[model samples]
Target: MNAEPADQIRLLEVQALDSRIAQLDHKRSTLPEHAELERLGADHAQLRDLLVAAQTEESDTAREQTKAEQDVDQVRQRAVRDQQRLDSGALGAKDLENVQRELASLARRQSDLEDVVLDVMERREAAQQRAAELAERVAAVQSETAAAEARKAEALEAIDAEGFRVAKEREVLAAAVPDELIKLYDKLRGQGGGVGAARLYQKRCEGCRLELNITELNEVRAAPANQVVRCENCRRILVRTADSGL
Candidate 1:
């Protein structure tokens, strides 16, 4: 498709803006804050799971401690009743012997129960400490996540603002080119790695970064000044300039 030479040059401007917009989009997607946020999110989830497990352990151990204490109390209460019976002098000799033996058994049971209580209490304390540590970790991860999110937002805002500006400039440039020319350029850009036009500087097609052959250079040199030229290698609209080295 043929466009005025000046119009062809405008295509380069539009292409530059498009390239800038593409770069901005890339920057937005690959922001360091995005990766950091992802890592923080994972850490937060793991910490939350640990906290839940710790809390469950704490609760279970607490229940065990409560039961142990209750057992100790029950055994002590039985011993107290036996002692009161002995003090009352209300039992025969054999009955008194049986009561004293029962009190001794109760004392052994009470000691065993107290040991169980102590063990459970230790477990509960450990669980509580683990839960506290996990909670602190969760809080730290949450703080980092929040900060990363804020940084990500700031980066996106900056990228979007620049993208908007470049897009606006592209709109003006695209309006200057004829419809058919713009259509061809757009199609080429889609298939040509985001470049639809390039400057022919020093006999090179800047789009493909390849120098044109002698025959191609001669053809371009002979082409009318107002006619549009394309690079034989990259098939992009080749904009000529004084430095094209025709």
Candidate 2:
């Protein structure tokens, strides 16, 4: 392929812009906020699960406490009725003795029910505390996650802006080159490592980081100034300048 010397030089500018665009893309993906958000997301999920379990326990304990209180109330009501009958003297002697014995049994039953109610109350209080603590932890994690997401978004926006600017510059520079030359460059860039053109500095192929052998340097030195030359090692367009040391 043949391209004007100036046009071939412009290809290097396009390559530089392309390299910058690639760097910006890499920076966007590897932003620190991305990792932070991932960690925060995991914590939030676990905390939410714990919060749910605590809430369920709290609900269960609440129902248990209510049932226990109801049992205590029923026992107390029955004892009150028995005591009223004994005080009214409405039963014969034998019947009165039977009523007194029933009252004693009801008292014991009420005491045991009251103890159960107290135990249930204590358990419910513990569950409520645990649920509240877990809720606070979940909220803290959510706040952290939100902050990380905001940071990630800001970083991406900046990277995207720079990439867009570099791409526009590349488009303008590439447009000035001959279409056929651009086609060859694009093909080589796809096959190579994002570099289709490189400067031959001091008789070295910058693309492959290898100095050209004596034979390769002689050929390049003999080539016409307008003729496009490729590096023997990397097959990239070798853009010659005064520093080529031919």
Candidate 3:
């Protein structure tokens, strides 16, 4: 393949632009905010699950408390009815004695049910506290997550803008080069880590960071200016300049 000497230099400019774009893309992916957001997201999800569990426990305790209170109320109502019957004096001696004993039994039963109601109330209060604490934690995490997401968005937007600008410059520069040359460069870039061209400076192939051997240097020196030459070691297009030390 052959391209003008000037065109080969332009290819280096295109390579520089491509490298800048790649750097911007890497910055976008590796931004500190991306990792922060990931950590925050995991925390948010775990906290939400805990909050939901606490709320469910609170609801269950609430229903238990209600049922206990109803049981206490029913017992109290029965005791009151029995006491009224004893006060009416509408019974014989044997019947009055039985009514007195029945009233005593009802009082004991009511006391036991009231104790159960108190126990249920205490448990419900604890559950409510737990749920409240979990809710607050969830809200805090959500706020942090939102802030992280905003930061990530801002970073991505900046990187994308710079990448877009650099890409436009590369497109214009690459368009001026011969399509055949650009095609070969693109292929080599894909095969060799993103770099398709390198300058031969001080008898070194900058792409592979290796000094060209005497034989390779001689071959490159003898090549025509219009001919496209590749580095023997790295297989990258070698663009020579006055500093090549040839």
TM-score of each candidate structure, all chains considered together: 0.95, 0.91, 0.90
Displacement of residue 55 (Cα, Å) in model 1 is 0.8
Best by lDDT: 1
Candidate 1 lDDT by residue in tens digits, 1-246: 567888888888889998998899889889999889888888899899999999999999999999999999999999999999999998999999999999999999999999999999999999999999999989989988888888899889999889888898889889988999999999999989999889999999999999999999999999998888899999998999899998
lDDT of each: 0.92, 0.91, 0.90
TM-score of 3: 0.90
Largest TM-score belongs to which candidate?
1
**What is candidate 3's CA lDDT for residue 168?**
91
Give the C-alpha lDDT of model 1. Answer: 0.92
Model 3, position 188: C-alpha lDDT score: 93
Model 2 Cα lDDT, one tens digit per residue, 141-162: 8888888888888888888888
Give the 10-residue window scoring lowest on summed lDDT in candidate 3: 116-125
Off by over 4 Å in 2: none
**Superposition error at 30 for model 3 (Å):** 2.6
Model 3, span 1-246: residue lDDT tens: 889999999999999998898899789889998888888888888988988887888898889888888887887888788788888889889988988898888788878888888887888888889889888988998899888889889888888888889999999999999999999999999988999999999999999999999999999999999999999999999999999999
lDDT of 3: 0.90
